[model samples]
Target chain A: MTLLKAWQMPIILGMVLLLALFLPQMQLNLYVQMVLMYVGINIILTASLNLVNGYLGEFSVGHAAFMAIGAYASSILTVLILPRRWGPAEALRVVPLIGPELANGVYLVPAVLVGGAIAAVAGLVLAFPSFKTRGDYLAIVTLAFNMIVKSLLENSGDIGGLVARLIAPLSASLSADVLRLSDAVGGPRGLLGMSKLTSLFWVCLWVIVSLFAMRNFIFSNFGRGVVSIREDETAAGLVSVNTCQVKVLTFVISSFFAGVAGGLFAHVLQFINPRSFTILKSTDILVMVYLGGIGSLMGSILGAAVFTILLEVLREVIPLVGLSEVWRWVVGPLLLVTLMIFRPRGIMGLREFKGFLPKEEEVKPQAAPAPP
Target chain B: MPQPVTTLVQQTLNALQVGSVYALIALGYTMVYGILTMINFAHGDIFMVSTYLGFFAAAWLLGLALNMPPLVIFLSTLLFAMVGTATLAVIIERVAYKPLRQAPRLSAVITALGVGIFLENFTLAVIGPEPRTIPPLFPLVNLNLSGVFVSTIQIVIIGVSVIVMIILDTIVRRTMTGMAMRAISFDKTIVPLMGVPVDRIISATFALGSAIAAVGGILYGMAYQLDPYMGIRIGWWAFISAVVGGIGNIRGAFVGGFILGFVEIFTPVFLPSSTYRDFVAFSLLLLLLVFRPTGILGRPIVQKV
Candidate 1:
């Protein structure tokens, strides 16, 4: 029993890794696999959003903006920047290492991280305004940020040309490449024909990494400062929490994870558009965050899973019950309303599931000295 | 070539027409926020529902084939939409918002968003996705004044909006109910102790706000296409207008609405395409928020340590 308890985390992680490696190969129904893929992406989105909204107590209604940034950045890399002749699957087919089929998955990590890094930088947009604004004003700032990002992409067609023209004086040949790259974004129509690089193993691996990263961050000293700021900003600052730094770092970290999810999402659909990351999409993330419970990591996982599955089930069941698919949209919000009315703090509220609790939190209890 | 004065005047008129509708809708947002301090995310959808109400009312009135005067048809449709939308807003307040009054503010905001989605999708499900418009109740007359053309519809829309604004301003500034509202907004806990019917006042706020949005809806439907999802974008714009002018402030909403109207109308003139309209509007909002966090007219919130 002692040995099992000691190895609990690794055992569970090993099991998840094993499952991810074989799940796609099981030949599950195509639609089922796609739904599972969405479930994974949404879980990542919910977890990252929870860091800012749940733990930090800031209402960011524009997480999708960061997701869009990540999506566009990674998609541009894979589809436009990478040499056409060096397609991952073809180049790695001869290498018998990590299985030729799975070798292509190697490129996806860096590409997605690059997307995330760019999105983390974009996080400054919200972080700076947050210094002064709070509540609804901050919410509006996030909403405006979402709109600005979407419109920026939508107008990228003209923007690209303008940039190219501006650069024409510097170097004619480089300007041509800049214009071509911008055209590849596909404007309002959306970027398409991305190589299907996202696999179950990669998604599972990233999900584990993100969940672990978020879990540790929340338990760290900085995370304590984040929660303190949420509870009472002035008090936190009085206590030497460095409230500004904590808030900015929290936003960036949250944005980074959201971007990572976006990268995976782009490759999953093998297409992306600005419209895909609208306020409505952000609202969907918000719904999941609230539904799961604020300030609870486990709640995010449960909320994302339940919300995604419920919608998928409704999509199937509504048509079977003599209602059109459009009714699912109506039913979805109706369910959310009922949920809100019943459980105002959400399912988990501020508590965590037993399995998700840190080892010391669950095991040591009264015997352990409280950290100062 | 330099821009002609006629083109500038034509655009200014267009801005006024759009601004009137935005100002009307922004009033609803500002009022509700003033009383409750909650963003009524569904207000835009209420505006949407009002337009549909106007559409059906106009359709039914014309279908009667009574040969009623055009003026009568327009008035009845407008009245029907206003009453119906007001009732809807009151019901939403009682059912969705009232229970969450003691809950966290974010919960109320989230519920408002859910209500918004429900309203939008409910409309989509029942009405289908095809966009609709109210048939013209009165004949339109385009009057050309020295190369600048103005339509009678534009005149009516601008005229009615200004009249409504004056009436609403008078009510909030002068009437007992408006005094109660302002008192409650100042201190909700103290006002009820002073004999204000808090719930009724809140419901009244929602009704008044929704009614004003209905007027804007009817006016907007007369000039533009109406769809269920129309509320989301327009609502956000009006919400921005409210924030830009300083939320919870009435006159500020008016000013912010016109600013957004000018942005929308003039964006295409300066930028390559109208696609940059949202970009410009949102950037303006960001800049304004950074410099004037409380908005143009909003008093800065003093943090109490």
Candidate 2:
């Protein structure tokens, strides 16, 4: 069968949609549901990150920063805009475009999309540097951006009050109270009072969307250009692939999806701190990407699901043995190390699932080869 | 006018002290990068573990003994910490890194990160989350220089760091072993043809770098309160310094460390608080990389087709 006739993507999408709608009915309790939600979000984060780390061959250590941007953006929007309770009668009066009736149900979808878009814009800042640098330097730049974002978030506040008055107009206030009204973000203590909008349904939905978009993008002309650049930038450039453009595009798209994942996480947990989006979180995503197998999208989803489940299982099982806390820090890193040592190519290498089975023409050698 | 001058001088000394520490750690980073082209992500955690070793030695081993003189106990504990840390570091390289040397850079890096996480969590589990008090080994004597009050320990930290750096510089330039190490760093492929024992040299490099980090860790514990998480922030700063100075250059690491330390210390004085210290250092690093990616003293890395 030709690549065009492959039903893998549609089948995967349909399976995901069905799972999203019905997985909650499974015998698993709320705790299990929350863990699955987390896994779904992580799947989005890891899969998107693999596009850059695996497919584009660029090392970014600040992927969590984009997630932070998305989380903060989505949370702020939800806090400021989402109506707490809208009855059927009142909901119709306030909500624009969709009116009060549909607003109660569909309002979240737009907010989440906007949150992802905001993260993509933030990603552009880091992506622009990829025009010149790659590899370790790119990693350092991303790490720096991560620190910068964290510090900025930590110090963001109003231009008044005791601490604020001291620095005043010259510097941003670090105190939360001074900027209470103006500051959409909840500086230092982090954004709070966010609604628990991230359900298993929403997370799985975005995970499906993120995976589908990335899968399609990878097989697209643009994705091929990215792969070409990854194989050899000089060669790609000679062949008319704009290496810089591809790099920036991949970074932006990856960051955008990472942000959406972040939004899902923030709403699910209903709390976020600067510590939540540290280099540790970035490492977590990187581990998932590498453990799943770098360039394989299916591997990323599998990796994220496995890691999330493993983490939850460890949390549940380790404490029972009286070493619960110790297990948290030890298990993840140990698995990563073991994986690198024993299976550095991960569960899969660069090859996707489609590459596993022989083509119909290959199975039948007498058949004429398909045209390019 | 006097106030500003005094503040400036004090900040400068503070920067020097911090920079000296960064320089000490950056040496380990630079040396490892120089030899293997692999960032030992575990280097920071190794430093963290060494600090805990020093802490344990000072608080439990030496601090308990009443018969021994304070100075002797301090000296012996420092030696023990350095040796223990060096051994741990060398073993890690031998077990974890040596096997992956022929593999991709990512494999070694991931393994290093794994080692780092393991070390950190192991310390956390063993020592508990509570920050252990590092009993002050050196007496806290203050010397008023012109007007600025300086502690004897701070001076000692600066002095020991400079002396060690000088010795290292001498070893690298004047000694045959150092010459061989340099040759290997330049091109490992040709070193075997030159009859140099490349594996031994690489292990020696790891031992030397780890030993330096252990010393730095001890001094760091003396300067500040010891904690398991201490290595992370300082490790990052040292990495920034290593990059700032030019990654593979030893002298550059020293220069970068001091420059970073001074910038971090003084920037807080001009700015609002110390919270932005990382931002400032990293921003400077980014700007420098944007302008001169090779770093201040680093030679431009030429890529092979």
The number of the candidate with the highest lDDT is: 1
**Residue pairs with backbone overlap in model 1:** none
TM-score of each: 0.97, 0.91
Interface RMSD, model 2, angstroms: 1.5
What range of 10 consecutive residues in model 2 chain B has the weakest lDDT sum?
B61-70
* Model 2 TM-score relative to the real fold: 0.91
lDDT of candidate 1 over A1-372, digit per residue (tens): 989878887789889888877877888777887888788899999999999999999888999999999999988888776646466444665776577436656667777999999999999767887667567766888899999999989988888999999999999999999898889997898888677888777787888899989998998888999999899988898999988889889999999999999999998999999999999999999999999999998899889999999999999899999998889989998888888888888888899977666776676545777699
**Model 1 per-residue lDDT tens digits across residues B210-259:** 99999999999999999999999899999999999999999999999999
Which stretches of model 1 miss by more than 4 angstroms?
A84-89, A363-372, B1-3
